[model samples]
Target: MLHLITYKYNFIPAGEQALHIVFPEQINISENQLIQELASQLRDSYEDEITDIAPAYRTLTVYFDIRKTNYFKFSNKLKKFLVNYTLEKKNTYGRTFEIPVCYDLEFGIDLADVASFGKLSIPELIEIHSSTRYFIYMMGFLPGFAFMGNVPDQIAMARLEVPRSSIAPGSVAIAGKQAGIYPVASPGGWRILGRTPVTLYTPDNPLPPFQAGDSIKFKQITRADYEAIKELDAHGEYQLKVL
Candidate 1:
């Protein structure tokens, strides 16, 4: 049976322990914002019963304790609350951060290829990329890998035709409309343009420093600057300012 909560969503059970609130099939900024707000409301209201509330691109997962609340009663109550939920007129602009990146060939193996693909000079590509402020749409695919969006059209290009076996940790790359840094060494397809020296994830911190809805700006630096920051980062002395 199809259970529609509103014109924009349908609620489906994800087993006896959770429910998935799905939005429109298409990916849009407004739809994502709506999901974020809805997930925030669920967490605020049902903190005791909910074990977790996670929002992805367009779906909100509400995880609850089966021992504390049955799916039937809990889902019904959630549906009713959502039916009356109103998205606030004022937008919540999350924290802004500036990440330092060094785009020298030594760190950016695919830089030449990416520049050629975009029909841009290496300097031109870096200028366009660093000038734009990106929005953090979601953080997944790996721990602390922020899925930021809206890379400039001039520099926006498709991912590599073939995925690389592995990319270095802190490698900054872009694919489609999104850009992100590899927090750990792993296989990926995104075209590499640069690398940041910041440590985005660590066992010492339970959660990543940034969250979804945050804004990020890429600040370009010289290769010398990258090495300096890298040394500080390695020794736990580098500090990234958040506004």
Candidate 2:
């Protein structure tokens, strides 16, 4: 007999037209997968009534059309479909991305500060960060800004008390348990330790490069490699490796 796993979730009204379907407030992969599956089920069942479905760490916010469907109608519709829904049987280990990050002083202004704060050498800090594979929990703050998780406790630090006015694009930063790249030149408070040459935000591409439930590994590179990749990337010739 095939054993099936069904998870329970909560559907709460976020706004007049938005509903938030949430799993337990934790950072487990199973909870994230359940949230993703819930978003998937909603799209499959209510394709016309739903305008947008956004998944986060443990919650999936569904935006619906008020003119066509309200909370009462939506809940009833979900109950019917969810009873028959089963989790997909496939690999969810997630893709491993070899993102090239340049840790030179020019790109990583806060490298020394972060290293000093962690009571480690710059090389030690980079090695620890590069070796660990990070999980993609959610994408938020800005388009393509992926909120990845579980920065090794040794180097994890709190966000800056005062945020910078503007941070350069491609800056790889970490604060608390989360790490992310600044997809655009935006104001931020995270501790920047390096920068990747890869372009994260692609408006022309329908789907963003990174999605929730993905994984990332940073590969250390020199400044020369960063310049080379940047040039090729500008011409649309560079391709990032995924394993």
lDDT (10s digit) by residue, model 2, range 1-243: 111235556779888898887667777776676667668778887899999999999888889999998988886777676667676654465777778999998888888887887899999999988998888888888988888877988889888999999999899999978889898899999999899988888678534566887888899999999999999988989887897
* Cα lDDT of model 1 by residue, 109-152, tens digit: 88888788789899988888899888787878898888887787
How well does each candidate superpose onto the true structure, as a TM-score?
Answer: 0.90, 0.87
User: What is the clash count for each candidate, in the order shown?
Assistant: 0, 0
lDDT of 1: 0.83
Which segments of model 1 are wrong by more than 4 Å?
A: 1-7, 90-92
Deviating ranges (above 4 Å) for candidate 2: 1-8, 79-91, 202-207
Model 2 TM-score is 0.87
